[model samples]
Target: MTNVLILGANGQIARQVIAQLKSSKAAMKLTLFLRNADRIKDIAPADSTIIDGDTTDTDALKKAMKGQDVVYANLAGSNIEAQAKDVVSVMDALRIKRLIWISTLGIYDEVPGKFGEWNNKTLGSYIQNYAAAAQVIEHSDLDYTLVRPAWLTNKDEIDYETTEKSEEFKGTEVSRKSVANFVVHLIQEPNLEVKHSVGVNKPNTDGDKPAWY
Candidate 1:
C-alpha cells in the first residue's frame, strides 16, 4: 500500500484531496498532518492517521515522516520557506522521496500580459515567499512536483488544464476542486510529472484578472 502523508490537511484543496483519496479504490494509507488536530478531527477519514504539529519542528516532522511513501504539502504563510526547508531536511534524512507541493502562479514571472502585472502587484511579497520555498524544493534531490495554481475559487467543479514551467501560465482562475483533482491524479500515478513544476487553470477563463477582481 502507498503511505501518503498530507501536510496542512485543513486547507481547502488538501481537504478535497483527502476526500477523493478516501473514496478511491486504490490501496493507500493516509496520514493527515496539520497545526491543530481538532480542526480536522470531524472530517478526517476513520482509517487515516492525524498528527498536530508545526512543520518547522524537526522532531515533529521526523515523527510524521516515518514509513511514509509520499508527502503532499499544501501549506501557506510568510514563513513558508522555513517550512519547506524543514520538510526537505526531514524527508532527506529519512531517505523518503516523492513530494507534491502547492505553489501559486507568477512565481517564475510566467504569467503573461496585463494579468501578469496584476498578479505581481497583487501578490507582492507573498509571491516572493512562495518562490523561495519553491526554490528549496527544486534544489532538493527528491522526486518533486510543484503545482502552481492560478487565483483560486471555491467553485465545486473539477475542470482545468496544465502548463509546464517553461510555458506561460494561462487563464486567471481555477477552482480548488480542480487543483485537488490534479493532486489526486499525481498521487495515483506517481510516475507522472516527477521533478516538474506545473501551472493549473480553468480552460477559457483567461483575462487581465480573475472575475472577482
Candidate 2:
C-alpha cells in the first residue's frame, strides 16, 4: 500500500482531499496529522490513522513520517515559514522525498495586471509569509510540488487550470474543492510536477479581483 501522510488534515482543502482519496479505489494508507485529532476523528476513514500534534514539533513530525511514501501539507499560520522548515528538516532526516505543498498566489508577484496590485495590497504579510514558506520547500532536496492557488472560494465544483511558475498566474479565483482535486492528482501521480511550483485558477475568471471581493 502507498502510505500517505497529511499534515493539517483538518483544513477545508485537506478535508476535501481526504474524502476524495477515501472514496477512490486507490490503495493508499492515510495518516491524518493535525493539532486537534478530535476535529477529524469522526470523518477519518476507518483504515486511516490520526495523530494530534503541532507541525513544528520535530519529535511529533518524526513519529508521523515513519513509513510514509508521500507528505501532503495543507497547513496555514503566521508561523508558516517555521512550520515549513520543520517539515523539510524532518523529511530530510527520514529520507522521505515527495512533498505536495499548498501555497497561495502572488507569492512570487506572478499575478498580472490590476489584480496583481490588488492581491499584493490585500494579502500583504500573508503573501510574504507564504512566499517564505514556499521558498523553504523549493530549496529543499526533496522532490516537491508547490501548489499556488488563486483566491479561494467555498464552491463545491472542481474546475481549474494551471500555469507554470515562469508564467504569469491566471484568473482571479478558484474553489477549495478544485485545489483539493489538484492535490489528489499530485498524490496519485507522484512523479508529475516534481520540483515545480504550479499556479491554479478557474478559466475565464480573471478580473481585477475575485468576484466576491
Candidate 3:
C-alpha cells in the first residue's frame, strides 16, 4: 500500500482529496494533518489517521511524515513560504522524495490578456507569497509536482484543462472538484509528470476574469 500524508487537511481542496482517496480502489494508507483535530474528525476516511499541528512546526511535521511514501500539501496564506520551507526540510530529512503541492495560477505571470492584469493588480503580495513557496519547493531535491490552479469555484463539474509551466495558461476558472480530481490522479500515478509545475483551468472559459466575476 502507498502511504500518503496530507498537510492542510482541513482545506476545501484537501477535503475533496480525502473523499476521493476514501472511495477509490487504490490501496492507500492516508493521514491528514491539520491545525485543528476536531475539524477532520467526521470527514477523514475510516482507515485514515488524523494529526493536528502547525505545518511550520518541524517536530510535529517530522512526526506526521514518518514512514510516508508521498506528501501532498494543500496550503495557502501569506506565510506559505515559511510553511513550505518546513515541509521541504522535514521531507528531505526523512528522505521522502515525492511531493505534490498546490499553488496559484498567476504566480508566474502566466495568466495572459486582461485577466492577468487584473489578477496581478488584485492579488499583489498574495501571489508573491505563492511564488516564493513554489521557489522553495523547486530548489529542494525532492521529486515534486506543483499544481497551479486558476480561480477556483464550488461547481461540481470536473471539466478542466492543463498547461505546463513553460506553456501559456488557458481559461479563467476551474472547479475545486476538477483540481481535486487532478491531484488524485497524480497520487495514483506518481510518475506521470514528476518535477513539473502544471496549471489547471476550465476549458475554453477564457475572459478578463472568471464568469462569476
Per-candidate count of clashing residue pairs (backbone under 3 Å): 0, 0, 0
Regions more than 4 Å wrong, model 3: none
Best by lDDT: 2
Cα RMSD for predicted model 3: 0.7
Model 1: per-residue lDDT, tens digit, 54-100?
89889999999999999999999999999999999999999999999
Candidate 1 has what TM-score? 0.99
Put down candidate 2 lDDT per residue, 54-159, tens digits, no spaces: 9988999999999999999999999999999999999999999999999999999999999999999999999999999999999989999999999999998999
lDDT of each: 0.95, 0.95, 0.93
Least well predicted 10-residue stretch by lDDT in candidate 2: 35-44
Worst 10 residues of 3 by lDDT: 41-50
What TM-score, over all chains together, does every model reach?
0.99, 0.99, 0.98
Candidate 3, residue 159: how far the Cα is off, in Å: 0.8
